[model samples]
Target: MQLFIGNINGQFGELEAEETQHFSRVLRGKLGQEIYLTDGKGTLAKGVVTEIHNKSIQLELSEIQENFEQRPYFLHIAIAPTKNIDRIEYFLEKATEIGIDEITFLKSFHSERKNINLERCQKIVNAAVKQSLKAYVPKLNDLTKFTDFVAQDFSETKLIAHCEEDFERKNFKEILQPNENYLILIGPEGDFSLDEIKLAEENGFQGISLGHQRFRTETAALNAVFGLDWAN
Candidate 1:
């Protein structure tokens, strides 16, 4: 079922402007019509359209499912944005649907795109969550430089998904422990530079190979998300 995200304040299930438009114009929702709302924190609320104004709508929540489809562990991926915006957008949508917890854009040595539209990407994430009927919305971090990102503290098993064969790497499947929090680093189209790889390793990130076949930055990130889910 198509779902909408509601504001989380003193009262729950407050429809935002776009959602109000979607319900009032596109869906032609009637008064007292049953609708679903999500708080994007693993809570799903079933409500009915109670008030419909020219540019607004209010829902009276009747039921709620807390911890809806919660995953065993958190998976956060820091990836270099591809040159093409569509690829990053696709990754955001598909990964959210597949249950990614957090996404961080990296500006590595070989990164083609240094920036992205945060607001637009967020909308894509929200739309994907609604489309997939998920209550949790993945967090999208601002674009960060590779050096600064690596220095940040992460308690989980940190991994750098690189393609170079010079260094010995662990197979992703074998290293992943069930229900363990993870923070993976995926390089861009040109992959991480040798210095970048060395820096990551020095910062507690183990080299991890996605597979024998090379994958794009977005593909590797998306694969990591699914791989973690599969491992759990």
Candidate 2:
């Protein structure tokens, strides 16, 4: 079953403008065709095409499927955007496939890049969700300053990956607990500055290390995602 994304109960069925075009012209879907639709917020709806217009595709609700339940734990990563946008985009794609909950681009003191292409990153995530057949889409946050990003109220297990000495660092796998929300920080090419690391620690983010070997910004972020203990 092909799953299309739309705002659930947005007025004209579950189909949006782009979805409508794809249904009519791209997929050549006709009236009475069965298709699965998701609101991206967890609700799944079953519908059959009722009206196909140039600008809109309408569907008659056959059934309102069950809402999706995410993993007991949530994974939120705040990474410094890479100079190569493709790398960050790749991270978004793979992270979504692996079941990340939220992503935020951060501007660190030594960050090589300070801007993010949010629109393009979203498209990548959307494609990944469809490819992975996931019910819930990850939330993408706008680029934020390092200080501002760390100041958010997150009651989960928070960690920051950095390469500074004098601070005891634990492996992400060792520190993460199952069924608990987690927030991780990954720095840019130049990595996080000493002051930035201190600020994060003061703000409740525990210092951690992915491994001894150094990694790129995107690689470290993905490693953190994969290393999370999601069991239980």
Candidate 3:
């Protein structure tokens, strides 16, 4: 199945500009050919190409599926952006392909990279969604300060993954509950500061450990994603 990204709400819709290039220039898509388009908001549309113009293509919708391939649980991972941006990019791609509901780049006290190129990260996510044939688009947020992000009430299962050995940490697996919304925090290379951990704990966030083996920022984030998938 050839899947493209587009917002198809009614009988007629247009493909995004980049998608048009992929359809016409790369794939040589022609009119009347059937293709699938996803808005990345749980809407999967099957449509026939009706018109192809410069930098755009019109579609006549045949079928639409809402909540397409929706998962039982929602996962949100907020992780400190790694110094090497590529590592975080890899995590985003793989996590999206595997399945994720939301992602927020974190700027922690120990964070090496203070800024992130959200556009590039979003492109990677979009491509992964197409490649993985996933209907829901993971909600991506810009770089957020650790303190500010922690202060919000997620109203879900909240967890913080850190390497603070002095403080007793709960095994992530022990706290897994089916079909519950989750928000997990992954700290930077140096891990969350004692003060930051305390702040999180005070705000109802439980500190948990992914495993005995310590992982890098990106790897730990991905592990949390996988753990959630496995648990559910």
Query: Which residue segments of model 1 deviate by more than 4 Å?
Result: 8-12, 54-56
The lDDT for every candidate, in the order shown, is: 0.87, 0.82, 0.89
Better of 2 and 3 by TM-score: 3
Per-model clash counts, in order, read: 0, 0, 0
Off by over 4 Å in 2: 10-12, 229-232
Report model 2's TM-score to 2 decimal places: 0.91
Return the number of clashes found in candidate 2: 0
Q: Rank the candidates by TM-score, best first.
A: 3, 1, 2
lDDT of 3 by residue, 1-232 (tens): 7889987867877899989999998999999999988888898888899999988899988778889989899999998988888899999999998889999988899888999999899899999999988899898999998889999879779999998988779998787887988899999989999999999999999899988896888888888788878877
Locate the minimum summed-lDDT window of 10 residues in model 1: 6-15
- Relative to the unseen true structure, what is the C-alpha lDDT of residue 55 in candidate 1, on a scale of 0 to 100? 64
Inter-residue clash pairs, candidate 1? none
Per-residue accuracy of model 2 over 54-157 as CA lDDT, tens digit each: 88777766567554656667899999999988899999999988878899889889988878878888889988877776778899998999999898898778
Per-prediction TM-score: 0.94, 0.91, 0.95
Which residue pairs clash within candidate 2?
A: none
